[model samples]
Target: MECKATWRRWLLAALMAVSIVSYARPPASAGSDIADAAQAIHTHAGAHRLILLGELHGTREIPELVRLLATRYAAQGPVLLALEMPHREQASLNAYLSSNGDAHARATLRARALWQRADTDHDGRRSEEMLELIEAMRVLRGQGRDVAMLAYDTAADAPRNDANARDRFMAEVVRAAHGALPRGRLLVLGGNVHAMLERPGYAPPQMPVPMGAYLRDLQPVSVRIGAAAGEFWACRQPRPCGALAVDGSPGHTGPQPMPYTFGVMLERMSVARLIGRADDAENRRAVGP
Candidate 1:
């Protein structure tokens, strides 16, 4: 009886040890990659109050990257995540973020006009991944982190024909949002064009001054998202909008140019799932006979 009891005790201890080892193991390789990437970005972003992450919208990677960066920044101090959404949707965003993130909250958010556009060709801003990023931010806020989101783009009804005027308006909105969170780190995610600190040589003489140019005094670190090759959702004018192949061989390589402080090259770019279609379907279901 004594021998059997001793053996059982040993077996139990071994099982507990194995359990602890398994529990202490690091995340999977994919997670490790994300963590490493986030660390690299954080290291590069050292001491900069504003980080302008210029991305080719409609990619799954950029939104995930933003979420990872936001999580990292929120851990250190306050963080403001600014998106290229219309300024008018700010109220709905606030409500959704403050809510419990239940189905009802999500449905209410999906009902917004931004996600219910009649056009089939979306510009990739209204993506399911973007909505998920917002939900992730809400999760961070729920965890008591000082993370806030801002829709800094011009109102939906505002005239968008003038690129120069639009960029200037966007810059002004960002400035006000940053001012509100004076001490917090600001992360602005928008189109690569708007984040350019200087006009590229290829741009036309009348090309509008980029939004980043207006905020030059802030010394924002503009990081352009590059990719080797893959696909993304974009609307080529006059063409039906859909997943477009990215031919990254020509211009994706080489050293970083002026106006961009750094570059993050995604190994493989994938199209972000457009949420507008899904939202439209849902809306139809809600009102369907």
Candidate 2:
């Protein structure tokens, strides 16, 4: 009886050890994965001064990836992080980055029209994750890192339906930013289509020229984000904008080659939190009757 009890105690201890190891392994594995992905990004950034990351707008992963890359690049030298937001928001973005990332500064940034867009038009760019990314840049700058951000999209009042004109305008904005920071590295984040080096044969007539095509002379390394299956926020016209389901190797068009210089495959993706809605809810909760 004494021997049996001792054996049972040993077995229980081994089971608890296994349980502890299993629980601890996932977080470490996740960190490893992120580190590997960052290394891949670093390799690409090393070869090209301008790294264009074309991503699906509404995933939490891409923003985190951008933050990691920005942090790494800032350590080496000056770095510019450009986003697809309207140029009119540049003042607001600059102010937020310059200020202490406090509640008031966050509120001011959220007050912009981009974050308060109608639910039907909130296509994921104004995500909480993106806001967090901006905050991360602020933190980096506060830590004395030479980091800057640019809102390089077309102006809000510009003709929204003119794809080519919009791309040209965006490219010009990026060019000016690059010229201003000749020694600084730039990481331009935009929708996947805008990062294509050439217009795909299957592309619609509206986008005969992509922004990447316009900036090809700079030898920008364009990377397309890929996923096996996941959800992203997008509008399918006729359907309201919301989290949409994606399946079976999203972003891969077989036989016909894509214009991206390289690709980064994410294990899976999840929808990013909408910043406006979340902030509104938090405020309401704070002021409850």
TM of each candidate vs. truth: 0.81, 0.81
lDDT of 2: 0.71
Residue 146 lDDT, candidate 2, scale 0-100: 74
Residue-level error in angstroms, candidate 2, position 219: 0.2
lDDT of 1 by residue, 151-258 (tens): 777766777577688888778767666665657689999988898888888887767999999998988888787677788877775787777776662254223667
**Clash numbers, per candidate:** 0, 0
TM-score of 2: 0.81
lDDT (tens digit, per residue) of candidate 2 on 233-268? 877678988887755433442212458877766767
Q: Candidate 1: where is the Cα deviation over 4 Å?
A: 1-35, 249-255, 278-289
Candidate 1, clashing residue pairs? none
- Tell how far residue 156 is off in model 2, in angstroms: 3.0
